[model samples]
Target chain A: MRVLLAAAVVVTLITADLHFNKLSTARSLLDAAATPLYWLADLPARLGDWSEAQVQTRASLLEENERLHRESLVLQGRSLQMASLQAENVRLRALLNSSALVRDDVLVAELVGVSPDPARHQLLLNKGASDEVFVGQPLIDADGLLGQVVQVSASTSRALLITDATHSVPVQVNRNGVRAIAEGTGALGTLEIHHVAATTDIAVGDLLVTSGLGGRFPVGYPVAVVSEVERDPGQPFARIAARPSAALDRSRHVLLVFIADAQPKE
Target chain B: MDDSGYGYPVVLLTFLFAAVLAILPLPQWLMWGRPEWVALVLIYWVIALPQRVGIATALLLGIGLDVLEGAVLGQNAFSLTVVALLALVLYQRVRVYGLAQQAAIVFVLVGINQLICQWVQNLQGVGARSALFLLPAVSSALLWPVVLHLLRGLRRYYQVS
Candidate 1:
């Protein structure tokens, strides 16, 4: 009798969660309560980082600082050119009667935990609703798109990586502007582009970038580089695969992008 | 056998510790073989103190796990309730069984838990492509004796019953 009651409750909860999403508030409350568990799980990694910082040699630190100084000098020089280029682009857009592009704001978030189940490519981040992180916000690393925020609590959020089996992104070929959808193949390194014509101009090594057609991700962010294109005379569509540009397996910190228009109105 | 005094906190702490171990980051290669720590702990409590830890306790812990993993709210709850029911039914016989026999029963229980979770995941279109999802069951079975001993030690130290 108790088992029957529990089963009924489980069925109702699942149906409600899947259909109406009415339990999001309850989920967030549970997430807020569970934040300390995530922190506890992350303690070992944090301790390792702390010990490494404490044990670093002075000479090695000096050498790393010198390298960063030189790299910053080079970056400063490039930024000066970028400023002038941005001004020129805005002027051109004004002349063409097109709206000027707004730079996206990004919040840096540290990874707190990852999905325990290997089959799910989800990340738990340290930023959440308190940081104005909303569901569907795009996440990126230094290299490319990483994932999107799926659930947010008071101080923590969960993101599903682009390499998750259920995730797909709209992308265009950088070389030819041909559009296609890149679907995750449940592997960290491979994404599949389905339904391309056998005669399409896509080639191996072509860069793929977000086209912003879906309006979830910003335009022109590097997504992947085409790795293979198999065209067979027997099949009407070609089989293509690309490797994700983001360091999906290695990045410790990621950025949550906040587009001005996408932000909820106060 | 209604020794409710001081038993609740010890059981709750064990479950909390199990939750931490469940999400602790592991190397990619090792993740597939990671044991189901929470399920093992739940099984231990249900068997050792069936009156205190039954289907209701299982349902609540399962919900907490679902929240922690960001899974559908009732996915773990349903699976764990089933595990608790099986453990409850078999507790009498399991109490007198040898360690090897107990471990074999645990394998079947955790395997069923994994199957139900995978079925729910498949409905959501994110299920694993191969039988690798069952790897945790094997690993959990292998770790059963260790978990059993450690939890038993803790239970004795705290005089849980």
Candidate 2:
């Protein structure tokens, strides 16, 4: 009995991954069932957001206002100094406008849930295919590139974060424009730059951003900041590490960069 | 299988709940440390009602997890099948043990389950895992007593055969 059961187990492993192979219709039903559950699972966070907004009472608001006023005064003083360098910054932005890029139309989506599986770092967003969210759309946080949409549902979608061990993006050093592929180091705050030559002019603290080589992400979102550089005389590649831009845990909201033609071309 | 109290319908409902739990958007920080809720619940069923759940059930859930996780289709199904086998092995001997002993046995099974997950991940060529993942294994196992208690209560209170 056990032998047959074990054989059946092997068969289950082989055939069970329904894999959307013949279950296309079933997936839609699954998504339909998931929509209300997404809202339910997100209730705590939504309530948190609501209560947070509610918790800032008049007294705290006045205190916050006072602090903002003081901070604004200091920033105003700094603005005069920045005005002198404003032209150069604008010129850089203009220069970056073409070869490099920045986001234009973005929809901020609340991250509703995440896969707890350590192997895959993916997110469930409140936005879905119904919201014009499509595959290959760049998901980013305020800090940097998060991941792109891999699956779409009517009410929710899945995003693979950059820190997910499975993900890789082509990146360029902001300082020298030296391009290399940055792979997830399988940690939330870290990435590994693959095959940077020992002779490469890379340095610690150099900024790394998407190079748009894969054309999966945008031209140049700040992806990471190089944190370490390990050079071995015998090894041709320098072991380099960078901090990922998106700290997916700290914030509930992120921007999904929506483009007219969002599909990535080979 | 659909009894008024406990049966296939309840199992199906659990799958729906597990699927929702499986796909909920997690924040970046907590993403890696997330627990396999579907796996946990399914393991409970396998341990509780072996007749209803076994390799085939685990495989189906694994496939669902695969589509939900967006990995190669069979990756989780394969590992889950392995877990189902573990549950079957433990099912016989586990009943003889005390609650704590049963929980401890479950802990070992969870460890093996996590090990299988790591192995599957390695095979998939995406292997930057932390030891923190074992946290869920421990956590899910530790919860076994409570899960069994609640589920047993349901089985008794609802009076399903």
Candidate 3:
């Protein structure tokens, strides 16, 4: 009788969670309780990072500093050009009577841990609701699009990666302005573009950028590059696969993009 | 029953340690084979002290794990409760077995636990990539003997009920 009762309760909880998402608050509270455990578990990695920092030779440090200075100079020059380009873009939009593009605000967040489950591609970020992070906020690394925030707790948030099997991003071909949806294939290296016409002109090496169609991701971030384009005669649509643009497996720091419409006004 | 007063903390502290290990991140290649540390610990407690640790304890710990891993609520709880109950029922027989034989039973127990979790995930349309989801069960079973010996030592050292 006790076993039966426990099973019934488990079934009820599962049904409620799957259909209604009734346990999100409970999950968050539980997350709060488990935060210290996460911190403790992260100690080894943190210690390794600390020791690595401690052991860096002065010559190597000086070289790194010089490289950074050189990189910053190049970035500064590009930003000056970007300012002029933005002014020109605004003038052109005004001439065409189109709305100006919304500027994106970004917050730097450190990757504290990753989801232990292999089936899910998620990263736990150190910043959360206290930092005003909301669901569906876009995350990016230094190079390109990463993913978006999915679950937010008090002090942490989970961002789904673009390579998760269930995740899809709207992208446009940088060369020809052709649009397609790149769906993750449960593997980090590949994304599939289904249902494109075989006659479509998308070619290998074509760069893909976010289309910003669903208003989920901001427009014009690099997403992926076409790697394979197969035209199957038996199928009406061609199958295309692409490699992600960002260093999805390497980067440790990510930026959360807060768009104008997504943030609540103070 | 003299040590019953100290039993709860022993159970909780071991669980806390297991909780940390269960969610510790592994490299991409090794992640599939990461042991189910929390389940192994829970089974150990259920078999060692069935009167003190039972289905309720497993349920709570399972919920804690679900939240830790961001899995669906009650998924681990359901699997863990079933495993705990099975361990409790077989405690006498399992307690008498040699460590190797006991590990075989643990392999089956954790395999069942993994299968239940996989079933729940599939039901929600979140299919695992392949049969590799059972890899953790194998790894957990392999770890059982060591974990059991260590925990037994800790239990004796601490004089836990």
Candidate 4:
């Protein structure tokens, strides 16, 4: 018997992605149907985590508590400064008669799971389409950029970390104002600034931030620092590498930022 | 040798169990090595009873996997259906193959399943990942003997008339 079932899949792939849309919609429904099971399965893992947390050393817990208290004080001071700055900016914008910008409504999500493959680094966020979160929305943790929602279901979504091999972002050097695109090199803890001319005034220690050149990522967030710059006098593009500011290995919770009325960055 | 009347319910129970395993959330670091538990159980049944199990079972289960894994909708379905076809082909003779040979064949089939998965990702317009993509294939195949044994027990437990 000719089991051309596999052939049908191949044909579907060749025919165009449109036919796959219906199948995807159907699978999405299945994904929704499966959410309760996902939550139930997560119970044991949550229990394991609770047990582990209960075993933290007393001294270490005290130290962490002290650290958090100190951090909270610093944050309180910063928030006061931020209030003053916001008032000043609003006064200036009002003087110029410019409309106030619409602030993004952020949905906080806890990291639930990660991509099963070690070769790739992506994360599953607790919020999903059901939470009004959508794909293409940028994710930001306390430190800085986490990633963006690439795929979202009703109960959860997946963020492709900027460190992931397939991810790319537009960036600028904070010092020189030089713009470049940073691409993920498929490793944890590293990214490459591609297409820098040899004559480019690139230097180690230059801070790279989201340039707002790409409408995807928000402007002025810290992305990476030029940790090493090797200009092979022989090659056209300089070999530039940097580290992401967000600790891709560590952050447990993040905010999915929806720019409520963000005009596409020019 | 047919238990569609009795064993089918056990198979459904296994399906639920596998789906639950897939959905179980863990801390970010530990979630990476999660096993393909559902695929293993489905493959076991298809091999054990060719007459009782068929293509639609694989497709539906693949949909469940797609939802749980959070891959593009049809990606798991595509890879899993491919697994079902191959497993069905080997169903009758797979039992007679000695332990070592069986283990090797299991590895190859699991590897093929992973490749089908990679292919599906490419179709979904994602980049190809490291060779570490094959890690689950080894883990799943290494798990085959145990998964098979456990299912046999479940079959007996639930199928008792």
Q: Per-candidate TM vs. native?
A: 0.96, 0.78, 0.96, 0.83
Q: Estimate the overall C-alpha local distance difference test score of candidate 2.
A: 0.73
- Provide a comma-separated list of chain B TM-scores, one per candidate: 0.96, 0.82, 0.96, 0.86
Clashing pairs in 4: none
Using DockQ, rank the candidates from best to worst.
1, 3, 2, 4
Tens digit of per-residue lDDT, candidate 2, span A62-139: 999999999999989988877547666667878888332333579999877666565667787888777888877898
Q: What are the RMSD figures for all models against the true structure?
A: 1.6, 4.9, 1.8, 3.9
Give me the overall lDDT of model 3: 0.88
Q: What DockQ score does model 1 reach against the true complex? A: 0.85
Residues A175-194 of candidate 1: C-alpha lDDT, one tens digit per residue: 98999999997877999999
Tell me, by lDDT, which candidate is best. 1
State in Å the error of residue B136, model 3.
Answer: 1.0
Candidate order by decreasing TM-score: 1, 3, 4, 2
Assess each model's interface with DockQ, reporting 2 decimals per model: 0.85, 0.39, 0.72, 0.36
Docking class of 4: acceptable
- 1 or 3: which has the higher DockQ? 1
Q: Kindly provide the TM-score of model 3 when superposed on the true structure, using C-alpha atoms.
A: 0.96
What TM-scores result for chain A when each predicted structure is judged separately against the true chain A? Answer: 0.95, 0.78, 0.95, 0.82
lDDT per residue as tens, model 4, A11-63:
56433433435454454456566656756766776787899899999999999
Answer with 1 or 4, whichever has the higher TM-score. Answer: 1
Task: State the fnat of model 2.
Answer: 0.41
